[model samples]
Target: MPRYLFLKHYRTGQTPHPNAADRWTPQEISDHMAFMDAMIEDLKANGQFVGAEALSPRGTFVRYGGEGKPPVTDGPFAETKDLIAGWMAVDVESEEEAYAKAAYLSSAPGYGGRPLYEWIEVRPFLSEADTPDLG
Candidate 1:
């Protein structure tokens, strides 16, 4: 089975549901979390769940500068254009299955108990199966 990653981003432009989480009521937030938990449980029951995580917006870019001349650091890029909120990894049989799962995840509720319908990026994990025969 191929593994895929579903990435949720903090995009502002062209968002179908633009309810900021900070503005959501406590119950709405809890309901959203509960929905996510249920989705995970369903995926697990189907043997498709691999792992998931919610990322801290505060993050830094680090680079190995020279041999050992102290690592170079860039930013705690909370305001970057491509900010990722979270991700869920799934091992499934096909790309379509991955897409379906991502679509379901995007249906997670937002404020007013309406579906967020936010975009979920689906990317496949490459493996030996993707490599061509060089012989």
Candidate 2:
């Protein structure tokens, strides 16, 4: 099975819900989270769920320094356009399956119980088994 990563960016890609989540009501936020949880449960039941994580907007970009030196970073950058809201990893039999799953996830409800219709970035993992033969 090939593993795919679904990247959920914050207000960067196309989406019906353009407003920030903070603008939504508390109940709306809860509803959105509930939908996400239910989706994960469904994926788990199908044995396609590998893992999922919700990221904090505050992210630090770290780069390798010289030996025995601290990594260099420009401090936390929480720019909404550059922040990734989260990611979901799924192991499936085909790329189509991955796309289907991502599409379903993109429909997660947002403000006013409306489908977000968000754009999800999907990419498959390259494992040793997928390495091309050079001989």
Q: On a 0 to 100 scale, what is the lDDT of residue 74 in model 1?
A: 72
lDDT of 1 by residue, 46-135 (tens): 998999998776676778999959878775453443678899999999999899889989999988899989889899998997899898
Global lDDT of each model?
Answer: 0.84, 0.86
Q: Compute each candidate's TM-score over C-alphas.
A: 0.84, 0.83
Q: In candidate 1, which residue pairs clash? A: none
- Candidate 1 Cα errors over 4 Å, as ranges: 12-17, 66-70, 78-80, 132-135
Q: Give Cα distance to truth, residue 42, candidate 1, Å.
A: 0.4
Candidate 1, residue 63: how far the Cα is off, in Å: 2.6
TM-score of 1: 0.84
Residue pairs clashing in model 2 are: none
Query: Against the hidden true structure, what lDDT does model 2 obtain?
Result: 0.86
Best by lDDT: 2
